[model samples]
Target: MGSSARVTEPQPLPWRTTRVVLWGIGLWAVALVVTLAVPALHTGDRSWWPWCCVAGIVLGLLGYSYVRRGRGNASDA
Candidate 1:
């Protein structure tokens, strides 16, 4: 009797995750900018918009970096 090993194929990259994060960040940034530019829309809370925009930018960059790193590791493997 002979024993055989079964091989499985590698999974494909998750582009949806990357796209979602990118779009989420983009939308948030746009909203933040609009809110900041229009004082009437903010209803007297002006400071929050700038902070939100900055935070969104940082989060977006981090998400993008993570996705790229995952892709690099997958390719290396």
Candidate 2:
């Protein structure tokens, strides 16, 4: 006898992808601002902190553009 089972796919998100990416970029920007404004945050080895935030913002922008072009998702089989 063969077992009977069914598989279900997850639902897609309701929010737009660009909004999510923007939120991440905004957070990174805030972090960069705080890092720059507070001397203690980047006084020594941590001086590279601001760059991390900048990278996040830049990558988020790239992802936003990729999604906007509708090429972010893979083709369904």
Candidate 3:
């Protein structure tokens, strides 16, 4: 009898995850630049700072999730 071996097939990842990651990075970068330039905006309210920070955090979290997913798949493969 021939030797029995298991063969595993590679699965393709969803494109939505990749798109989210790319968009997340883009948004994060934009937020960073805006935060840095906020002072130059000359707004005395100072409320934009908090909003910008929050946006950055949200984008970062999204990016992290995608990265973690990719890493998990890589490790599994």
The global C-alpha lDDT for each of the candidates, from Candidate 1 onward, is 0.76, 0.86, 0.67
lDDT of candidate 3 over 1-77, digit per residue (tens): 69799788987666655666667667767766676676754266765774775677686776668676786346566
1-77 in candidate 1: lDDT tens per residue? 47687778988766666687788888878988787788776666565666777788898888788886686344667
Greater TM-score among 2 and 3 belongs to 2
In model 2, where is the ten-residue run with the lowest total lDDT? 68-77
lDDT of 1: 0.76
Clashes of each: 0, 0, 0
Regions of model 1 farther than 4 Å from truth: 1-15, 41-45, 71-77
lDDT (Cα) of model 2: 0.86
lDDT of 2 at 40: 86
Local error of candidate 2 at 77, Å?
Answer: 6.7
lDDT of 2 by residue, 5-68 (tens): 8778888888777788889989999999999999988879898898898999899899989987
Error of 2 at 30 (Å): 0.8
